[model samples]
Target: MLIEPLLEIRDVSKTFPQPRTLLEVLARQPKRTLHALRGVSLMLRPGETLGIVGESGCGKSTLGRCLAGLHTPEGGEILWRRQPLSDIRRADRSRRIQMVFQDPYSSLNPRMTIAQMLDEVLFVHAPSMSSAERRDRTDSLLQMVGLSPGLKNRLPHAFSGGQRQRISIARALALEPEVLVADEPVSALDVSVQAQIINLLESLREKLGISIIFIAHDLNVVRHISHRVAVMYLGQIVETAATETLFGNPQHPYTQALLSAIPVPDPDIRSLQVGVQGELPDPLSPPPGCGFSTRCPFVMDKCEKPIPEFFDSGGEHHVRCIRAHSSTFSVPA
Candidate 1:
């Protein structure tokens, strides 16, 4: 039996126009556009966590924002259970999808107390509920995220980074959203705090049976929590597969480099050194073909031409490199 995807992104593209300088304006130069997402496509199955991993500025956050309806895409369509996302009413969409930002402190309102924050969401989504009902719901939300309901009266400023993030999670769950777009939710917290939040999210997913799009550059964290993983490069997803498959046998050169960079604690075992070469391509004017072509050690002449399509290596393992289409293609030692 085939289980349909709960959320589907098809050929999505987004661009941000740079502000024109006075000199450029006077010279009649066209405004530069940053290609944030380029024909990116993926699927999120019901009750599964999908990890999106990439270097900084690889459009991971942009994709998360798009999923949560924070930013409108310039091209392509996102479907929520086969229905176009744009066609869904704002109120209905808010109840189904929620976002947890990277910085807990910045995402919360300092003036609003923990109770007030959660109450606001409930008030908006469940206006029919009485004040008593809303308060009860608020208390439950706090407790659900492993927070004390007694701290509800305190403002966001009074809480630590991890506590603030718990509040954020509570607020996001106020409406009982079916999908959560967690955009580097633990990145700003301390190392110890990061693990706590990660465990919290993992537990919440199990308890609520909610789908999650976990976006982050922390490969280790993603590997621990994600059922599947997608590797992004220069605003495009270069590879995607089951978590173990991707980490064990990465097909793309970029993916291989990222995995090789992971720190191996064992001094006895020497890890491969496939570090990526050169800097990321400028977003304002990305390369014509494969985004990693400029830095790929095994780049062929064809990699500089027409962009490659995803080649399925096996069930659920897809790679965007032209070389992956050939059975014998392997990264040189």
Candidate 2:
């Protein structure tokens, strides 16, 4: 049987106009525009976590904001269970998808206590619920995220960074959303804390049957949290595959470089950095053809023309590279 995905983002794109200086403006000129997301598409199934991994400025956060309705997409549609996301009723859509920001410190309101924060979420989505029911749900959420309900009286400033994130999670779950778009959820925490949050998110998915679109710059961390991972360079997803396949056997040159950069925790495995050298290209105006072609070590003439079709290399793995299909391109051993 075929199962329809909980969310589908189709051919989505977002472009932001760059700010111009006084001189440039006076001269009747405009600063170049930034193409944040260029035709990005993906699906999120029920009870599954899909990770989007890339470096900073790769537009992963931009994509998250768009899906969260914080930023409107310039083109294409974001569908929630086969219905257009924008056209749906606001109250109805809010229950379907929620966002958990990367930094817990800034996300929470310092003026509001934990109880107040949680109550706000409930008020927006479940206003009719009695005070007792809202309190019970909030308490349950706090405990589920490994927090204490008694701390509800404390302001966000009173808690540690990790605790604040737990509160953020509790608030996101207040609406019982089917899909959670977590943007770099643990990037701001200490290494030890990062692990705890990742584990907590993983545990919550299956228990709640909540699909998650997990965004992180760290490939290793994304690999740990996601069932499938998509590797993005600049503003485009170069490759996507099941967790094991993407790490064990990456197809795109950029994906290989990214995986190779991940440090092997074990002394048994080699600790050399096999990552690509040089700076990332400008997103304002990407290369003429393939966005990664400039950084791709295996650049070819055909690659300069245009990106090849997004092809599946058996199973659910897909890569947007000519090399994936043709022997014309091969990684040097």
Q: Supply candidate 1's per-residue lDDT for 198.
A: 94
Clashes of each: 0, 0
lDDT by residue for model 1 (1-333), tens: 768999999999999999999999999999999999999999999999999999999999999988888899999899999999999999989889999998989889899998888888788789999999999998888899998899999999999999999988998998999999999999999999999999999999999999999999999999999999999999999999999999878889999899878876654222444778999989998999999999998898999878799999997999999999987797666
TM-score of each: 0.97, 0.94
Kindly list the per-residue Cα lDDT of model 2 for residues 138-253, writing each as its tens digit: 89999999998999999999998888999999999888888899998998999999999999999999899898999988887888889999988888888889898888778888
Candidate topping TM-score: 1
Where does model 1 exceed 4 Å of error?
265-272
Cα-based lDDT at residue 60, candidate 1: 96
The TM-score of predicted model 1 comes to 0.97
Report the backbone clash tally of model 2. 0
TM value for model 2: 0.94
